[model samples]
Target: MTLATKITLVRLALIPLYAWLATRYGSSVSAGQPDEPFRLAAMAVFLTAGLSDALDGWIARRFNQHSALGRVLDPLADKFLMLTALIVLCVSPWSAQHKVPFWFAGLVVLRDVLSSLAAWAIWHRHGRVRISPHWTGKVATVLQLLALGWVMLQLHFPPSWIVMPAAGLFTFASGMCYIAEGWRQFHHGPPPP
Candidate 1:
């Protein structure tokens, strides 16, 4: 019921809208009549949701409104939004020309799945799991957002060749870091409170 949590929920609600618009735009491109309005609208919704993520986090920290539900919902919303965008851009025929590379998306998704499983195992064993965010993970997330935005906007200046590879590297590095942490947590038990 906090304002920050409310914003997070709103961001979650935007995911379906974004998916619909992005797929519609893709369909138009596949039909040989690319619709600028659908593309732009999808971009607008994506940006709004992305901005709301930062806003909610800032509000939570600044206003001391952190909650257990917020912690769970924030990451869930992020994963959903990012995964939905990746699938829409990579799998949809409309974005074939400017789609996110399948390899990169696969790496991102695999890391998330492995991380989730690791977390669950730790929780089941220890009754609690505490994972402090790593800088590499944060960098990976920013790179992912940049890559997603680049493909969504169809920007050609920097090129996906540079963007995607960099994102993939960071993602791999972060996944490795998480795997190490998870291993340590599993064997050594959760970190001290």
Candidate 2:
């Protein structure tokens, strides 16, 4: 297997580990007290998984090992990791007060769903694929991580009120960017008669 594929697989493996740690520690916390050991361990796991995201891409680019399979696997790993973390953090006892609102979660899932459908439609009609990560998408991912971290850690440390709204805005912006880009790519180099 290529280095990119290997890196993607490693990243994918980390997702479940991170999610397990998050849910485990987050659930272990008492109603009014923080579970320091579990919280720290979970945070470490989450940070490690997030770091692997950048690490895999760096390794792939550095080794010139980019592949179609890597492209698919890498994003799949990211979406799964983030979505799982968010779900766990939202439901964990530690995050009961700072849970990710259902509307935000719905919007996030809807964005991903629409993007997938757009990609599929493009493939069906044009026999092509576009997987470039946009700046807005990157920002949105960052916002999500920050928000999830805050919610997960809020039992030990109070979080700023800005995170939730910021996350929501970035998520909305990313969705809009994806929709615009998908439309442009679909219609590019075409002249409707």
lDDT of 2 at 121: 84
Clashes found in each candidate (C-alpha, N, C closer than 3 A): 0, 0
Model 1: per-residue Cα lDDT over 54-79, one tens digit each: 99999999999999899999999999
lDDT per residue for candidate 2 within 1-193, as digits (tens), equals 7876786787778777777776667666645555677777777877777787788888888988888888778889889888887777666646557677776777788899899999888777777766677888888988888888787667434454577778888899989998988898787822332
lDDT of each: 0.92, 0.76
Q: Please identify model 2 stretches exceeding 4 Å from their true place.
A: 30-34, 155-160, 187-193
Give the root-mean-square deviation of each candidate in angstroms. 1.1, 3.5
Lowest lDDT block of 10, candidate 2: 152-161
TM-score for each of the candidates:
0.96, 0.83
Error of 1 at 35 (Å): 0.9
